[model samples]
Target: MGEGGKRKSRQEEVPAPPSHRILTADELGLLKVSEVPAGDKWEETAAKQRWGLPDKAQGITRLQVHCPDWDPDRCLVAAARSSGRVTLHAGSDGGDVGSFRAAPPASTSGRSDTSTNAVQALRFSQPEGSTQLLISAATLGGHVSVHRCPVEAALATAAAGRAVHTWEEAARLQTISDLQAMDVSSSGRYLAVGGDGHQLKVWDLEVAGKAAMASTTSSAGPDGAAAAAPKAGEPLFAGKAGKPSRSGLQDLAHVTALAFVPGQDDKQVLVGTAKHKLWLYDMRAGRKPQAELVWGEGRITTLQPVADGSRIWVGNGRGHVEALDLRQAPAKLSMGHALKGVAGSIRALALHPSEPLIASVSLDRHLRVHHSTKRSSLAKLYLKQALTGVAWLPPLPAAAAAEGAKEDEEEQARAEAEEVDAAEEEEQQDAGRVARGKGKHSGRDQQAGGGSRGQHGKKKDSKRRKQ
Candidate 1:
């Protein structure tokens, strides 16, 4: 019935709905805080190509450096250089203060070979209320070594006593399966090892209440079918076989990095793969991953779970560093932009436990510090060589947290005050409106009644007189 085959409405025409889009910039007080610029040579600091090096100098083609938990004092720092020797450096004032050298791990044939081998990973275990120890592992021919913290410190204390006390080798070059990455638990109770063609293996260093390891041999079932059981009560700490954690037969795809989520009851463990996936397992539960995080096109080379288990930080071979909020669903997660120019895979990342900072090392021979929360560059150091490891100093006395009860009480009081003020203001306005409305209605009613009464009196008087 309409002009162009359009149906006519039976009711009156209605106006179109109003647009609901707001296109104005919010007037937030955005203060551009002054930033500490990277050093003028900062660009060069990240450069790997260096000239003018003596041939005999062995210009650090590959190096693995470890920074202890973000403490200001008594932090352990060590590096394995290209000269087939591991160096221990005392990190003080945010720089190297002293240095010492230890002989490389013995070869498989029980021969000490000082040939050039890359240290694949370095980890430090300083459990709460326990002494600190440094653990470093070299690749090319699996060599794992552990040294007490004081041995090097004692030598550094007495430089005149040139007799450099050698580190007590814990595990030698007996291959742990050509692993690319290793992680030591902060509690010093477990060590997670992973590498090429192997499932993640966690070694219990304190098994049976002593410093011991499981035997490195094939296990047998009752039927002698070569069951993959850890040897007896305390199996060998060699091989890819171990008592599987909650994530059974982890069977990773070329593990690239491993880390632990500390300060949690579950003590969740994270293993990253060269296939660009990360598996999160709850060690307290079973042998399967509780969750998985996948990112980027390249292998995820590093994973650093923050002090709390709710957030995770990962670096991949494609030069991407992303922050993941585990509380969100996989589809609704938060992420930061990729740190550009970061190349050759991020071999290591360390978060400052007390500060909003992160330290990262790459196979590209650069050490960069980023603000973890803002995802901004803070500082960078160029070692002119590939970096295999990194860590932040342990927490300092200045890192003490605010008193919980005091902070909670203050927040509660402020919230209560705001609520009370809002409620009182609402009550006052409501009472004023109610009073005005009552007075106006009452006056109108009185006027109406008076006019009716006057009319009625006039009519009654006139009718009576006429009667």
Candidate 2:
């Protein structure tokens, strides 16, 4: 607005771009589901489809999807209702995947009248690279269950694996009240679990058993050397989530999600919270978030690190999706929104491994595709159904390009690091004013800006210029 109409006219004189075309049904690529029978329910009006039913269901608390690979067709979807029952479906395209009843032990359920226990979250882990293991965390019982995909399928083979076989894993270190969110690294090496209690737990199983997944964070012995193998059944490390606290939610805001940078030796984990905050913890560096990504907003529900680990995609409750490139210094930090003014909370987002496109879903029943080539709208999908999750298909086999991938990642990391450093430098100067006692608390108050909270939370590129 400050630049005014003079700037607008100057821009208009350049050229008027053509209006964007909204693809017709025939023109848009088909969204096909081979496993489940196709139905119009997802694209129907309220009278035809049960819109808002899931949100209205007081008994249901959380929804989770379990896809072994990147393929959406060969996946399993599960929703945990407050009624203590978990419904699992094979696909939107054919047969029922399986429905399993998960409840407190028989001895425990007799003590309570609640029919459905609120399940907080669920995640899939593929440690040791065998079959996928599904895990569930619930509120009241503080229980976690692990089920192997093939094992569950074999058991259901008699019934088509439509029968869920849930096995109780070792009791989780923390209860639901302590839990905030959970994530399994892409390689299935470590399970990062964080909660309102301010601690992030890194469960390492590289030496736990025959199905151990190698950890990239693991290093050779002393002074840049290799270390010995861990005991056969013990975890390499149960790295803490955050500093310990007496009370979980009261002491710390609940954690919402955790994401690890893909294809990196450093175990850098991105953690998001309900307070619209993001922090980065380098497992190789410290137990707590050493760096933070700050951009003022309301509560954040989702955090996804781009493949390179230098950039992060975040979604907040107010329907804002932003890409925080972490390379710039604190003094010169810049932010760009992929989409703004969305209808509902941006709850789920999926990033393409190789492309600049990002797919985001909102509870308001919208799905949008954003292009990373600046704040441009590549396409928007108006689904008749509210979207709960979205996973972009990975690049096809024929699309493999190793050299291109390496170059892209390096460039992205360098750019993000520069931005983060610039922002950090500016914040440091602000912090300096207070340290000199000129104004004791003015700089601290400036932290309300969000991204300025931590100066060195991100890296910096060598060429970043100072003002």
Candidate 3:
């Protein structure tokens, strides 16, 4: 036993771990970097303080922002704290729209099971052709709950009365343990979830949404015995089921990251494991993974598939972010666009739904926003707090993006205005001075020569008469 009553490891006797210097934006050759302002001014730029973790509990664990590409306005950004506190921020500027606690599902396991330490996974989904968004939060205790949030209705309620309720419980999902990660599809048809021991399970959210709708109409069972209300944390698969992909490897590593492949009608997904490898699966085929690609090192944290499906961007620990093309026979990887000069492991990566930007938060407390198209560093900001995760706030309408662009352009124009054209100014002054000089000379010549002109004319007449 060492100093604290525990066995000391040999590595602990050695020197401390080497620390890598965090690079500046200029040193990293980055552009358009925005740093959090000193004091309370930071509240104007980022919402860290506005949605911060309470001073009492552990820090924030996860964050998810709603990005509605269409004209949707209700659900904006939400933050989940370590003490099971969830706050929803809505509107253009992310404000506290709603806050709720994920109380342990009653009768789940037993009455004694009351609460979980923190929210393990948080996801926000908007079903197709639906006015409300479904929010799913899973706890470490394997209890998951889904809630329906109505943005406009909440605002209307606030206007009518003092108290405004933005969201309500939609459905509760059965408890699943060690849920490492989860993702919802773009079409909002399916949900891909994975974690320790449990493999990938894709739930048909459309079916779940329909069930939620049906439950509203029939409050009682046909026998009139008063139907058992759907448990707040009921297993979604128990009623509306989803297909699971087969990965033949029984000795599977913990699933640390998950992404639904695009342009496949939601039939394919890419799963990243803790073994520093990637396994691609096709839901339409057998359970075994279709392809496996090995990265050099580091635990995979996030995956982003390109629109064309030709390349996939993978971010991992040790600050390694690179693109991989699985089409080639050997799964050719690209070193051209890798994010360099990044220290610390990436905790989360979020890509803008409509814009060419990808946001990444790492252990270094830096939130890096990169250009997705060029794969270059656009901006990097340090929010002071140790960031655990990040996600893009749901996109506003085209007009809002356009307005933001307009504001940027106006600022650029103002900056350009400050750089006056010195050459042009000098040229204009010289021209004015020349014009004034000519005017003065002309006036003097006209007055002095006007009287002499008569005398000269008389002399000319006398000379002509003499001749």
Candidate 4:
């Protein structure tokens, strides 16, 4: 083939660049519901049927994303329902992958039970240099169970009404009652739980694992057979109560949210309480909180920290979301502006993995996205059910990922071009200054020479006149 034909072939081989821009907070404000892609919106009824959930199944209570850094290809989102069931979804498309019951069914034998065994929290952990994924689920009944399964097996297709794998329960904790919050450290070594009992507890999973193994080996029978051993373990660190009030009564400091500070090696934690208090505790420094801050009047509901642990976004029960800078001596609101558009109590808050966007679900049944910098409402969608949790699915789809890459390339190119232009402009300005300086010096020299020559001529003429 000739050169022109070969060039044409090469051009055809290259895929066309996507005709879309990276989604921004400003653009989100102008977006309409109809303009939203069909795949982006979740149809409640259709989703129920697709997931084989009963028509009257409870709404989603919690959402957790499992995106391990070791394996970027493995991204999964788990949504726990109020009915004690947790359903896994493909992080790329929000498609239902599998479901499992996290809590046992409630008794129906005329028991005057006021509280349901709904899942209060869910966390996903994959230890470093490990192939298995651990899912920690905490129910209101005080049972915190950690289940383990291979990543591939958990994501594999299973028969309808069955889990992808028979995930083995690796550990269990029945210490805290009415558990309202729970978190697993990034290292997968510590598990924290807190609730109405006004106590914060942390468990060392490494110790628990060793204890479980030792118990299993010791319990072996004469035939060298041993049954599955109980993995329940006590908390390695338990926080104590605060000082008494002026009325000589202890405060009802209900623990609502817990988060491990990043970069602290899972040794420091930030706890949110129902009494409008935020406490920072260092596990190595004893049981008392090292620092505390009071923000608004509402009960604290959620806490999300930046990657470096410099700041945290705190959500309260009065529909307020504020970012507090931890670097401050007494951690104060950093954003200056609070996230708006949430009309009811915020149920959950999720930070975007790559964007400066904050996703929040409220009791008003709306999912709102706000700009992290501007703290302005970007987009808002109304779902029919009472919104409980919201999370950003990671490992975006191929088309979206490619589009994002193109946007990043374009942005980088623009930035480089701007820098070059700025440097050239600065150089030109310096050249003009040098040229002007030379001209000024030449003019001064000419003036001086003319004055000297004129003075000499006048002196000679005066001498000649005298002669």
TM values, all candidates: 0.54, 0.54, 0.60, 0.66
Model 4, span 388-454: residue lDDT tens:
6666543344555455446556877999999999999999999999999999999999999999999
Q: Evaluate all candidate structures by whole-model CA lDDT and list the values in order.
A: 0.52, 0.50, 0.59, 0.68
Q: What is the TM-score (0 to 1) of candidate 2?
A: 0.54
Best by TM-score: 4
RMSD of each: 28.8, 28.3, 24.1, 23.4
Ranking by TM-score: 4, 3, 1, 2
Worst 10 residues of 3 by lDDT: 18-27
lDDT of model 3 at residue 307? 69
- Stretches of candidate 1 above 4 Å error? 1-75, 82-84, 92-117, 132-143, 151-166, 170-175, 208-252, 327-344, 361-367, 378-384, 387-467
Query: Candidate 2 or 3, higher lDDT?
Result: 3
Error of 1 at 196 (Å): 0.9
List the candidate 4 regions with Cα displacement exceeding 4 Å: 1-54, 68-73, 93-96, 104-116, 152-163, 209-231, 243-249, 328-337, 394-467
Candidate 2, residues 1-467, lDDT tens digits: the string is 56798788764442211111111100111121101012312222111111123343434445554544533335555555555555554432213455554544444325764542455555555555565454544444444434445634522322233554444342222223445566667665566666665456666533332322132125333565322221123333343434334555332546777777655553767677766566666777656566555565767788777766567777788888877766652223345666644557876776655567666667765566667666566445555544445554322121222332344468779989999999999999988876787554666566655555344444343235431
Q: Per-residue CA lDDT of candidate 3, range 401-455, in tens?
A: 4454465568777767755666678889999999999999999999889869988
**True-vs-predicted CA distance for residue 429, candidate 1, Å:** 97
lDDT score of residue 347 within candidate 3: 78
How far out, in Å, is residue 430 in model 1? 99
